[model samples]
Target: MSELSSPGGEMRLDKWLWAARFFKTRQLAIEAINGGKVQVDGQRAKPSRSIRPGSRLEIHKGSLSWTIEVLAINKQRRPATEAAGLYVEDEASREKRQEIARERRELGGQPQEGRPSKRDRRMIQRFTGRNEPSD
Candidate 1:
């Protein structure tokens, strides 16, 4: 069997998360775990927590969430396609994420592109009844 599927191998939760492509870096994964944005087996976990195959993970990042079961572990980060083989996402969680994404798309509130233009600022001020005195 390949190293990934080798039995009895375990890894740090944060390291695994980074290797699995869930976060861009191990530090980000650590921060998420510390901030309670990540849970293992329905309980909050530390960055150093050991995780092996079949461990359940719940991760929340802003409006997105994922519930996944670990399938394998790797010691180093890999390409996205390979990382995806590390876990299996629950079908309900997949559907919920898709629904949330669809709803956001339908809502269609485009984010403001940078600092608002002078005219746009004036309009906002006027709407908020906080117009500044003319310079």
Candidate 2:
């Protein structure tokens, strides 16, 4: 067992994001906040924003953004599912992400596996809607 957490409730938004695995570390969380990758309740917020159990967060990373409702104020990092419990994802964003991933997978660099002949190896320039060959 580890040291007990403070019962005084809530933690900083930056700290909670790190603990929830939304970012790899607290520094990353801060960077995201400062870089405009985070929003709260439809408005931009600072790293020092005090987040409570039900506060909603809109987090952007890469080509994705997640809308989550905070469920707890955990300062410790945990496993994926356990960390996921810290928030509930917005359904619209989840579906959007899924569609994006699927599109990327289908239109990305991977060629379908039936069989490629020697000629395919020679002129496989237009495989994934692009002229680049898959490595």
Candidate 3:
């Protein structure tokens, strides 16, 4: 009775995303899905796509990415720790994230989280040997 008869009784992409705390609102999840930021089983997905237990989700948000395997489906959003229980992160992706973060740290931590001043830019340009900087 749960196959074709379940009106998404399990979970949908947007709901899962919201419940998983990836997005603060279902609408945002939907938008992200429609914008191709959410992938189901390695293919791009829509917000209303039905998701069952054991499904894989690949999510991209700006510089962040996650690969999670669904273990349960819930309609309501849960607390952080509770929401975290719904999926197992792909080991490779986790490792890749860590590696990328480490590389970013070694590369000096993501642009200082602010705009660069002219002096900063000049200093960087000079230090990196990009040009003679108009003598």
Q: Could you say which candidate leads in lDDT?
A: 1
Relative to the true structure, candidate 3 reaches a TM of: 0.70
Cα lDDT, all candidates: 0.91, 0.82, 0.81
What lDDT tens digits, residue by residue, belong to model 1 across residues 85-117? 889999999999999999999989968899999
Off by over 4 Å in 2: 1-8, 110-135
**C-alpha RMSD values across all candidates:** 3.8, 7.4, 6.8
- Ranking of predictions according to lDDT: 1, 2, 3
User: Each candidate's TM vs. the true structure?
Assistant: 0.81, 0.73, 0.70
Off by over 4 Å in 1: 1-7, 111-119, 122-133
lDDT of 1 at 35: 100
Q: What does candidate 1 score on TM?
A: 0.81
Ranking by TM-score: 1, 2, 3
